[model samples]
Target: MHAISVRRVRRSLPRAALALVLAALGAALGPGAAPAAAAGHAEECSTEAGPYQKTVERHLKLTVDGVQSAADCAAIRTLQTRHGMEPATGRAGPETWRIVQYERAVADPSALTGCPHGTRLIVCVDLHRQLLWVWDGDHVATGPVPIRTGKSGYATRTGEHRIYERVEKQWSELYEGPMPFSQFFDGGQALHASYRNIWEEPGSHGCVNLRYDDAKRLWQGLRLNDPVYVWGTRGP
Candidate 1:
């Protein structure tokens, strides 16, 4: 009997020590340091909520519940649908978040940091954000248009440039393709309309491709010698 009691105490000691260690770890990591599954779920909800929280409250004119409730998710789905985003299944992911970020940046005047100071009627393209905006002094004339810039090997050049030539319908001699409303700013590279889906990944060969309507708008607004600023790098 004495031997059996001693063995039981030894077994219980390990269990008690494990519990104490777990408690200490939990305390160090804080309340958010839940079990793995619980922590993962929390992180997912947080990622889904981050980009659209303010957008939902301010622009979508809906309630923001940190994406914790069904109603909040539904609202986000509706917004995504309106914006033409695919798989609008009330689940916010990277692509959906990107669109939200772009919209928010367009609406915020302070976000136009790429536009040079004292320059009026400028074409600003943020490669990292993948957005284009036509700035007329303090006002935005016509953009926040989604654009596809040069892909990996042929990254678009940054810094200030000017539209040196404009052609309503230009043919790409190098690629033997149609480049409508071509506005050349950097060598053969131009800003033009591409029939391919601009939102689709792995963008242009070196030119900045805009949607048909946006290209038309830009063609009408931009003039020769107007500053065209392209900045930032395409993010991974």
Candidate 2:
């Protein structure tokens, strides 16, 4: 009877261990796991607060008043993500805001016009709109970039000209300043990257001042002897 009792006790011990292992696994992966995963998903879907949030919110409100849907915001976020802007977790940070503003400015009707017919490669500048665009035949290759032309006494010349030279890093002898990625199409004036803010009201001194990145892209796209058309008059 004693031997029988010992065997029964050993069998019961194995069952107890199995039950303990199951309970430990249940505690680890039971109710808490779902909530944690749900929280992570929520974070993935939501935008984080940041410096440019207010600006983004204001723009959205103005564009679509009384709308609770986040469609517009999401669209902007999607664009930001595609561009690899930071905090692409559906948030409009500084990088995203800057890009959005640039795009809006570029899309202005005054900035866009048909490239001259029969032109294979052309750089089109609209002084009235303060914009520059690169055209490959009929299709736009680059730009609608914001630019700063000459201000006040110094006025940018308007006409059809050809790119005479390209200097990757040029120092302006006249202005005593750096001009990166300069494509000179006319005498004493070129399309070059500027240190000054291109968006500012008062612009450069006769040279077409482009943002650095835009200048680089323009430099890459334009070849020597490419035609450049500058139109629109300086304000009186």
Candidate 3:
């Protein structure tokens, strides 16, 4: 789910070949990836098409998921990670292609990677907001998605922390893989994505589980060793 899209794709043979493949794939996703399907269930009818408050579904699909390109996707695996998504076989499932289609409607491959190197964009994952806000100077880009922080014995840490390293794709979580991205902090305390939301609510192993799209976008937008400040709504 790197921001580098086919649009930004160069005329290189590798990119061209991928585009040809993707055209077939994108076409297969047409009924779903088409503009009309922008919001999953009737976009124009949605009042909250309220700008970004709108979404069709989630995750992208690639017909040749594990083809091993020299591209960034070289990091991804073939199997569909548990609750996360795999590149759909082009059938356009509601969970994967369906969600990404809408992203296409609003996405600009060039615009997403605007954060310059060394510029610190403040990102605050407000548990209370149920929305993650990326603050670029005073500009805020927000998105709404499900997240699970912690349950009982494991509570999400509060206070300021700097992201030292980031993992684009992980393999340890076992089920859906260890999440595609982990802005690692102490040990396992990372801002990641998870499946067991315990009814789509806040529930995690002390890790902040952001929605997949949120994680993907944040992963691309954020640079190595970025700053993430997490504050809890619930007081100690």
Q: Against the hidden reference, what TM-scores do the models get?
A: 0.64, 0.55, 0.44
Kindly provide the TM-score of model 2 when superposed on the true structure, using C-alpha atoms: 0.55
Compare the candidates by lDDT and give the number of the best one.
Answer: 1
Q: lDDT for each of the candidates? A: 0.68, 0.64, 0.45
User: What lDDT does candidate 3 reach at residue 8?
Assistant: 12
Could you tell me which 10 consecutive residues in candidate 3 have the lowest summed lDDT?
A: 1-10
Quick one: best TM-score, which candidate?
A: 1
Model 2 Cα lDDT, one tens digit per residue, 85-174:
433555555445555555665656343673473458789887765668877866677877767678777678888999888889787655
The superposed Cα distance between candidate 3 and the true structure at residue 218, in angstroms, equals 0.9
* 1 against 2, candidate with superior TM-score: 1
User: Of the pair 1 and 3, which is ahead by lDDT?
Assistant: 1
| Native-to-model Cα distance after best TM-score fit, residue 147 in candidate 2, in Å | 0.4
Over 4 Å off in model 1, which ranges?
1-76, 87-94
In model 3, pairs of residues that clash are 57-99, 58-99, 62-87, 82-176, 168-180
Model 3, runs deviating above 4 Å: 1-120, 142-145, 173-177, 195-202, 234-236
Clashing pairs in 1: none
